[model samples]
Target: MNTKPRQTGRGGPRGTKNLPPAPDNKENIDTQILRLEQLEQKFNVEGSNTLDIVYARQENDQHHATIQAQAAELERLKEIVASFHASEGALGPNITPSGSAAAGSTQDAPKKDKARKHSAAANVDDMALDERASKGQIGAESQPSGKKGKAPKPSAPTNVDDMAIDAPDGAAAVAGTGADDEGVSDTTAALARENAELKRLLAAAQAGPVGGPAEEGPAPGSIPRPKGSAGSDFNIQDAMGLGHGRKNRKNYKSIMRSCRDLVLQARIDWERPWAEVSAATKSKAFAVAEERHPILARFFNSWATEELMKQSVKNKRNRAYKHDGLEVPEKYAYLKANAAKRNPTAPRGRQAKLGRVDVARKRAEKKKKVATSSIKTKKDAKGKGKAVAPESDEDDVEMKQYAPSEEDESDCTY
Candidate 1:
């Protein structure tokens, strides 16, 4: 049986009273059609609005469901993480998979690892079972795999906040102190460096350098040099010296004869200093009487010993033999000459540095000589009735080429 309304022959509902039949006139029919079209359009607009409301409500319900689902999932994840964290400390040291309260706390490493994993897995399963039980999905008393499945108690405190807020003044004061310390440290380092440099400079200034010996004169406490060419040192070459107004040895024959006479006089003894024999030591000692040649006579033992020593020094120095004035018939001249020059490369460059005191003494002596010569020139000028005024200091510096720079007047002892 249909629940739809029965239509009478008048084309209306049966529940209503007898209704009028619509007029069959063209105008009235046209009016009724237009009214029907208007009603249909109104119904269509109302249906469209109802459909829009239904769609909006459906979207809102879906959004709310999505939010609830996300909340549930977040709760689940939180529970898993909380259990994971809690299980680490909650599992007692005695827990194990085949638990009968476990044997002891000090178990093997592998056993501990297995126990840790099993306890964590059991805790996770217990959390899931409890969760399911609250939703009536699982029994609340459902047992996990192991008997000792409960979490252990944490050893540390449960409620302690690690991070804290610091006071602004305290932080700023600390920063300022750090900066001051840094600045002070830098200043101290700089001052220390400067102090070291100053100390070095002061020490250097106080202890001045020592002057070396001079280059122009002999050293003190040394033997007075022979007044002429290097005595007994015949291989004189490139002598960078002032020569001290000495002459070359031009006559050796007369010198030996003079030595003989001095030996006879018994004056040339070991007690006499070499400086006393000034007349004999000069390079050109022409004061020796050349009238009598060196006779082949027996000489004094002392004189002969002195001459032998001099000859030995000459031989050691590789001195060249001179066959000029002296006659040496005792030995072959050719043999002596060749023997002396055999080791031509024996002698080396001289390195005789003079002392500062000796150099100063020589300079004073030269000044004294210049003064004496100037006085003599003035006296001679006075005698000639002429004014002798030197044009310059250079003009007053007179030097004779071969002048004998006679030392203290000879006592004629030698």
Candidate 2:
């Protein structure tokens, strides 16, 4: 509150009355800080969403790979069951009592089957021994030659087991299979040898196969290749030699070229979804291809023509896309082309179909909500919508008659 006049260094002191209030920049700075923070938060949110999508895609792929493996295993089991079923006689088969093969107590089936086989072998051996003895072959072969006196006419050694029981020295006769001085001993030795042979046959029968039973694998085919060789080419087509036909045509490479050329020349709608093709169209295309190149018919049938078309069309499309020239949408790309979506349960493996998964993709889809939905511009009259349907998908491209088209094309993204 000084009353004295203020003095300036050069010109006069500026008057306080002429000076404007100091400008406040705090509000502007605060607004700018808030905007920067909001932008940063938005960027973080977008990055997190992208990461989540990537993780989901990876998880989905893993699930699909696991399912594929399980499916292969199930197919193998099916083949084994079919083979066994075809081999097993319905009834009057193995001597394990009637209905035993199909009844309970499966745990004891192997043992019972072995016993049955052993008993059958023993019975056959008895029949063979009896037949030879009745023919007097055993007695003729075992007549003692060194005895000085006229040898007693050897009894036709029929039912040697009973003779072994009745003989005065039965223990000695049964104990040794070696030929000895007396004719009776020679006959006993021969019978003992036959018994030993029968035992050997029984043991071999019980042992199952020559090298012992082979393990039933997780899947069946040829022996699986070592896992270490997995990274190298193991394409099924190459392994199965799909490119090669019966002797007399061309070499593998030349045949491959011909196949490729044939695919390019074949008439197919490359733009249309594979599932959208009519059955007649598929067969016609295959027939036409077969007419042109008779050899292709050997490698594939009408049902498999789609595979050839896909390979050729997509391969050419990819080369064009690399140079940014003949590119098509991802959906139309050979590798990327999606088949028509089926029920979510369609891809489930055997175990998954049995409801064994921790979380079913189908059930989860049912639970999930699609937040992004567009307004429905058309609705069907309840009666007409359910009463009749279009003859073909082509005929109903615009939708049902009751559900008319509208200019505002609002769609829901599922």
Candidate 3:
């Protein structure tokens, strides 16, 4: 309680300057433990936080890895699916199951491994079963229930004639019996013999009196024969056109020659009608014309005679008037008139006749005028003392006015 300051040697009270350190006691230990515990707790908290971070990182890594693995697996599955679809497309819709199963095994490795062994064993068993079944079916179908399962006995051969006799009608069972056999049988033998005898008689009749005496030469009383014994020669002139009456023969030859000429002319001038042939060859030989040759006769018949006649008339009409530039001739006019009578639509015949007459009169007038002009020119030249006079019809009239000359002879030919 006294407020006095107690003086000590150094900083604090102690047993001595070198006194031994305080013994570590429970308290101290406890305190130190407490501190250690606190430190440990702190360390644990920090460690726990660090561990949590590490664990979180590890979890994140594991999650990412798992995702990657899943992605790879998905890709692999996609590839497998695509391959499966491709295989299905290649094989037809009803492809055998064994083929598909085998293909599928390649994509699903583990499953395929197991399936391969199983399929092989199954195939073996199936093959054996199939063999047994085939054998059984064959035996059942082909063999009969006899001693030791042998085949049935075949029937014995039967005589075809006997079978034919027993047949109802038209059965193949008796077809092997030939008609010759039937002919030789008792039923047909007599008829066949009679047929042979009739055939012999027919052949004998066809021979035509073989055993008769040789035909003698015609008796002296027979009709008189030609000098050549009348053997092979015979007159065929009657059969041919040559044997016709003289007029008919001449007409035929003329027609034939004309036809030949027409054909030749047609060949030479392709536009010439066959009808003009008769006129062209009027003076030619029938044989030379060759138009009536046997080969050409067919062509003539095909081109009917009436058509040829029409063509001839047309050619004649053209030749008669076309050269002079005049109207058609009388023959053509007559034809036209007849045609008009047959067909009322034709032009009038009077017009054609008038045209022809006008053309003829005009031609005559032109010729007379030419002659008169020539005579007038000659007389004018003579009067002018330039040339001698032309002796013509007009001069004759002028000369009549002058004295007649004794030397002029009317009987003299010009």
Per-model CA lDDT versus the true structure: 0.40, 0.44, 0.42
**How does candidate 1 score on lDDT?**
0.40
TM-score against native, each model: 0.15, 0.20, 0.15
lDDT of candidate 1 over 1-414, digit per residue (tens): 889887986888775575576565566446644754565575565334322333345568879997776666656655655554565456544433232235545245656444543443223334333334455544234435554867544332221111102322211212124343344334435545755665554454445434886575434433233335333232221121222333323224234434444343222332233444444332112112221223211222223324423433334233223433334445455656654653455322121111333444565577677777777889878676664553444322342211222221111111
User: Best candidate, TM-score-wise?
Assistant: 2
- Please report the candidate that would top lDDT against the real structure: 2
Model 3 stretches astray by more than 4 angstroms: 1-143, 149-246, 268-414
- Candidates ranked by lDDT, best first? 2, 3, 1
Could you give candidate 3's per-residue lDDT for residues 300-373 as a string of tens digits? Answer: 22222223333344455456555856475354465555445443553334444345446556655666777787
Residues 1-414 of candidate 2 have per-residue lDDT tens digits of 888677665566657557887655566446644754565475565334322333345568879997776666656655655553453333224323221333335356766543333332223334345456556576564457676886855656556576556655543332222321143344445545755665565555444336666565433333233222211334323433453564423443334443454443333455454566566545545554554455445542332334545455556655776775755676545433232332434433433333423344443343332211111111334445443332334323332321312311111010
Question: How does candidate 2 score on lDDT?
Answer: 0.44
